[model samples]
Target: MKVLSKSISLFVVCLIVITIWWIGTDGFTGFTQETARVNKLIEEKPMIMPITLEDSKGRMYTFHELKGRRLFLTFIYTSCGTVCPQLEKNMQQVYESLPREILDEKIMFLTISFDPDRDTVEVLDTYRQYFGSDGETWRMARIANKLELKELLDAFGVIVLPDRYGGFTHNSAFYYVDENGRLTNVLDYKDIEGAQAFLHNELLGSEMK
Candidate 1:
């Protein structure tokens, strides 16, 4: 009788272990499937911006260049005393935390300087160094004129004004574009972690179980 009771107890314990394992496996699989579905949905609805502009290297870049990659964009000028630096710093963190595969395979970063007259290629090069920018992968382009700058800003609903001290007063919003070049979300300049996770999970497909 004692032996039978021990055997029954052992069998019950094994059965429970197997059941827990099964549950865990199935739960993980479901989560993976859902994540893939979400990414596909996002890709299907990418935002396409019709920006026809030149980079610091004088190469023409537009919405078409972003067809197969995610993009992070913001407006800044080299001589700004505030806000622009903070936005660049936040972007650096986001860029660093991104997986190399995503950075290589699915991501691009663009910082277009709103001050055309001042932010020449030389100034952009200097500014890029402050952010440890590698010219091949990342870019800081200067707008050709105030009119082009205003049109782009208006299209994106970003506003800029000059202060009494010749400084810029501008909205600090970081724009996120998806793999299909669709503008997906706007992040605050200080929201580093939120932006990090947002980019990591969506652009890199990190939540792909």
Candidate 2:
């Protein structure tokens, strides 16, 4: 009787452990699948809508208006003393390296200030001038409306967190939009070669098309 009772207890413990393991594994798998599904949905959608925004010059235009030109865009704020400047510099280098025809006629660069409250038109203009950005080819702008700003950041997958120093800690990346205004590729801000290659391929592919 003692032997039978011990055997039963061991089986029950094993059964309990197996049950818990199965439940945990199943839940994890489901969560992973859901996450992947959501990511796919986001990837399939266009990066920007036709929402109108104000530029540093206070000119109103929708991103859709830029449909005929390839766009390289990044998020930045005038107050940022760290990553934003580096990002702008990298973008400038990429812009300078590209063929003048592409730079002049086919491509454009945009630096958008996420901190709309503080980064007014004057502030953005000063920031652009500080970077010595050519106002025509390289433009700086900000979305003035708070709600629209959040929506734009979310669309670009940019997460902004307030740092201890009253600056922002945000996702830093270059968003490459095709001539048709589709979000074709996203590269790290540090990847100057990658940005160039992407542009080359995109321009070539568009020519072929």
Candidate 3:
């Protein structure tokens, strides 16, 4: 009876260990699966609808100009004090980690402000300065037209809601587009390491093609 009880206890402990391992690994496994799924979706539908937007200099920008460059894009507003700052910081880290050749020649980093009413071209320029961005590799912009902004946000799956403190809450992530302008991957801001890995392995080399 004593030996049988000991064996049962050992089996239960092993079961618990296995359960913990599965739970710990589920997040990475899920992210990998999601990446595969999104890749397949891009393969099926190659083209994304083009939208016109304005940069901090009040100059018109379009997707056509982004062709043949790996695009790292995100949405943020100057008034946001919560996730936006950290999200941008993570992007900055990813940008700094890359080789200068990739940053200057092969990649474009874009931050678009969803709050057009409050985030004018001047305001975005100030915000860009605060982040120490030179606007060469990392460019900040805002959508001028309300209707077009709504369509752009909806297309990218960004949801914005008004908060009680006169600010807004929104989902933030990096939208990764290939050199061909195909929407490829959506990396959440929390996955900084994953973003860096994708940049080094997929974007910088010929593996992505």
Q: Write the per-residue lDDT of candidate 3 for residues 88-170, one digit (tens) a residue.
A: 88888888888877888888889999888899889988888766677878899888878888887776667788899989988
The C-alpha stretches of model 3 lying farther than 4 A from their native spots are 1-46, 207-209
Q: What TM-score quantifies how close candidate 3 is to the native fold?
A: 0.76
Candidates' lDDT values, in order?
0.74, 0.80, 0.80
Worst lDDT window (10 residues) for model 1? 33-42
lDDT of 1 at 13: 100
Candidate 3 whole-model C-alpha lDDT, 0 to 1: 0.80
Query: Per-residue alpha-carbon lDDT of model 1 for 48-116, expressed as tens digits?
Result: 556666676767767676677767888898898778898898888888887676677777888988888
Best by TM-score: 2
> In model 3, which residue pairs have backbone atoms overlapping below 3 Å?
none
lDDT of 1 at 201: 72
**Worst lDDT 10-window in candidate 3:** 27-36
lDDT of 2 by residue, 1-209 (tens): 99999999999999999888767556444345334433443467566777666787889898888878878889988899999999998888888777777778888889988998899888888789867687778899888877888888877677799989989987687887877777766786788888778778777557678
193: Cα error in model 2, Å: 1.3
